[model samples]
Target chain A: MAAIMAKPSLKTLKCTQCGGAIELRGGHNVRSIVCQYCGSCLDSKDQFKLIHKFLNQKRPFMPLKIGASGKLKGILFTVIGVLQYEEREAGEFFRWLEYLLFSPTHGYVWLCFEDGHWVMMHEVKDLPETQVEIVSPRKTRFKARDKTFKVFENAQAHISYVEGELTWQAKQNEKILYLDAVCPPYMYSIEMRGSEQEFFWGEYISVKDINAGFRIESFEPATVFSCQPFVVSPLFEALSKGALIASVITLVMYFLISSSGTPVMQHHFGNQLFADGETSKEFKVDKPGSLYGITVHTPNLKNAWSFFDVRVVDRDETNKLFTMPTTLSFYDGYEDGEYWSEGDTEVVSYFRIPEAGEFKLAVDGEGGTGEEPAEGFSLSGVNVSIREGVRLGHYTLTWFVLCLLAAAPYFVKYMLFEQSRWHDDEEDDD
Target chain B: MAVMLTCPSCGNQITQITRSPQVLVCPACNTTSFLQNGRLEDVGKSAILTDIPSIFQINRTYRHKDWKFSPVGRVRYDYGDGWWDEWYVRGENGKESWVSVDEGEIAIEVLVQEGLNVPPFEKLSVGGVLMINRQRMTIIEKNRCTMIGAQGELPFKVIPNETYDYVDLLGPKRSSFTIEYQAGGVECYKGVWVDPFEIAEA
Candidate 1:
């Protein structure tokens, strides 16, 4: 086994004036000693030198106890801690919170609730005394819940004045302190402070004077708790769910309404040609008056014509509303060299009924017997039914049927081919 | 070349008439000076004076135990006759000094410890040289003089040389003393140096 080496003992030096001993470690030689107890300066030869005397100067290794309480976003919180620090070469106290809070990982977002609204803020920088500027759109007031408690910000935690006793300890002459507290996220802001001007987030209160001997101080509460954690209620959840359902329903209705077809009425009157020499027998439907309840039958002619022209004129020749000319066409019809030997023929066209009136109907050789000649010879058929114009019930029924027909394919796709499992997860989470 | 000494009272140049003269009378001032044995007489009138140039150079490596402890501190003084100098020391516990001569030509150097207490010296005096060891302080006072080695001394002057059987003086404690150099003329002062290592341990 290899032999273990013993560690060298550190040389300890004492100040002549104050009897303070500063231990030098690692066997390093020191040329001077400053008494932390009396602030006296000593040379290597034991000579006393009167250097500059510090007045109202805080000890670099002093521990400060701070107490602060305030309301943030409707929640009241309190903080109590002992801050440890030292003097920089520039004679400024190097405060820890001033540097730690502003670190990228340490920076916090504060949300304060007041006046029925939540105010968010980020800490800017700290100034001396009990003041700090928030990097928010406006300034916010930070006050303790009780008048007896003191609230401070932007002040040096280690050097700020304190009304109570505090204690601290560190490794051998090294400085250390203790802190304890609970604070709300909203009341906090980030700021740059300390001798090096680093950033930190927190409020300041009292600074305790911990003499050189101790390591830990007694813990105490800074302020009373006044608020509880905020929890969202189920009422809000229900209202939000209702709003979402309403929106979805409205969107679906709009899609269905926009995709539905319009109502149309078509009439047939003439013959259809399949082959050049092969012509379909003429077929026609003619009705007098409003023609709302008339039905006409024709011989089954394959390749039959599906178009018809209707004219409605008043007795004084003023062009009656129900006697206006109308054209009709159909979807299922004869192809070239084929005849529409059909049962119920489908018709598609536009028609309008202007007013209540009687109308005469006639078909002759694919053209109606009228002053305006028809292009093809029209079929002959005549019938009459008295009433107003086309029935509103019929138009409504047709629109309903068309809508059902159009939605059939989409319903099948959604149920089988595009079925999603997302709905189940949403339901389970809810 | 022959060595000559100038008489301070009459400003006349004088030379040794013999190597064993007990006393030499100054012809210009009619002053008589006695020599101890054959060695040059220690008249006690000619104080070891350091010029502003030499003092400033030497002080660059001078570290004290107390005042201006940190090298980041600033030092400024006027060496009389409108000659002002400012110095900025860098690094921790280091020593540096500067002088403004005719508004140009500044000299600077770092002070490094050779052993425990001895510090290296550069640009000391006017063409004179100095070398300090941990156990001795040596000075080549002039170009022609033999190197005077003050041996067996402590880094600091706590006890007189005669008290200890085998004692060495280390370097002076930098924090104890504060030195200000001015230049109406040159003057040298001596004082006791102390050892801070002893005082701190005590």
Candidate 2:
């Protein structure tokens, strides 16, 4: 329960310990006020009597001073108190500053600043759904309100310093166990001290918003925080979507337009007798600048090799339009007590027809066996075939590569960002 | 209808502003009195209430969002750590309600007398859950509050310096439920938390 004084009046009282003037801003609800001058903790209910003297009280780095009023989300809150906490584990120390904000309407809220990050937290009464199951020794999972949370840290924290007014008597060096669970941009925390446990829900506040709310330009976070949500750029999102749409369109076009070309020429040559050359009958290329598919096959060549220097000649036989060179070979034997084979007996290639006109196939090549001919085995001949207006498979392969190239950078960046957020979980697991 | 009564101690005319108020403090002499069977009975001097800055005053109307009510009387209670005030207010519709102010938080509540199954105060603890009128509510605070003072006119009897145990439960959307265990009987109030900043003098 909270005490209401919609219009809070300042009560100035002299400190019993040091006689320094102390200002109380929390109305009757303030139980303790620390003298900023002499570091004396006084009981506000008992004539400001000295409860404890916090000696050597050095002020930590604070951006918001006491009695400073600022409006957050259209509600005005005054910075009434500050509590600095420290946690020590594995010979490492972590410190944070918590500013107690009081709104005449919203009761109490906390703004925590740690490592250049800020979170605004409000105490809640409803318990999370799953409190009995522990995901691991250091982590847990629960659902509260509407969000699912993954426990980020469970550690014991100690109060290192206190200033301004507090609702309860906050002692120096008090220790309490706190657990923090996060669902990006929001965090659920539980603090346990003896028989009392308090729950607080928090939201990550960006530096820009904090600066605007408090009217101070402070800092930028250099590391990922527990509740910092990953924001995707609109440009990147549009680019990724565009790439996907392009891929689908390319696939549909490939399936709709792809076809094997009409046969134009076919030729066969005798074994070891085509050293001069061979020519095919005349054929007409109907479409100008269309694609042509050429295939060379050595049907009777076993454990032997063949090479072909092919060219497309005009009907007048004066000028050659294209030159395509290819080799076909087949070999097999037992090596190291294992059978092995290399090279292919047939090969295919593609070329663009220069113009729509009459043409003829000119082929010249050589054939021979690598070793002495096996018993009753001999090389026979070579077969050559050509077709015009063909669509090759490499067209789809090229489009696929282009699509992947467009989206890979943003994908890698997103993955790295997610990894950085959970980087500390690996160490905790270990 | 308004009934006029005379203060026993001050000999001053006291106008009973509302029909349901049982207790009235004389503005002239600060004498606390209660009406029984249409006659004023003296209950001695009213407890001294210290002057503090507050949002509400007796006989003043305040508006919160769309609600319009005038605070007719007040009862102050002292608990552990701090004190709070329960202002008995009458809305424009002639329905009575309570505006509880504690540590800058305010709750506008109405007395609930039917279909409530409240357990004993000793069985309740902070952070415990309770089902009231089929709605799940969480008990946020349990404390014994002592009646310290009274002012103006109140609907219920005010026993000066009498202490009673009470538990406050919170429900969804800032709903508040309070169960007060008094010596006479158990009383319950159901309401919603109102933002103090939204309250304005009407």
Top TM-score model? 2
User: Candidate 2 recovers what fraction of true contacts?
Assistant: 0.18
Question: What is the alpha-carbon lDDT for the whole of candidate 1?
Answer: 0.29
How high is the CA lDDT of each candidate model? 0.29, 0.80
> Root-mean-square deviation of each candidate, in angstroms?
28.6, 8.9
Alpha carbon deviation, residue A248, candidate 2 (Å): 7.4
Q: lDDT per residue, candidate 2, B47-112, as tens digits?
A: 777666567888878899888998888999999677898998889998889999875578889989
Deviating ranges (above 4 Å) for candidate 1:
A1-188, A194-232, A257-260, A263-430, B1-202
Off by over 4 Å in 2: A1-8, A131-140, A231-411, A426-430, B1-114, B120-139, B144-165, B170-177, B182-185, B189-202
Tens-digit lDDT track of model 1 for A234-340: 66545444554554554555554442122122244334321111111222223333224333333332234433333333434444344223232222446796855
Worst 10 residues of 1 chain A by lDDT: A98-107
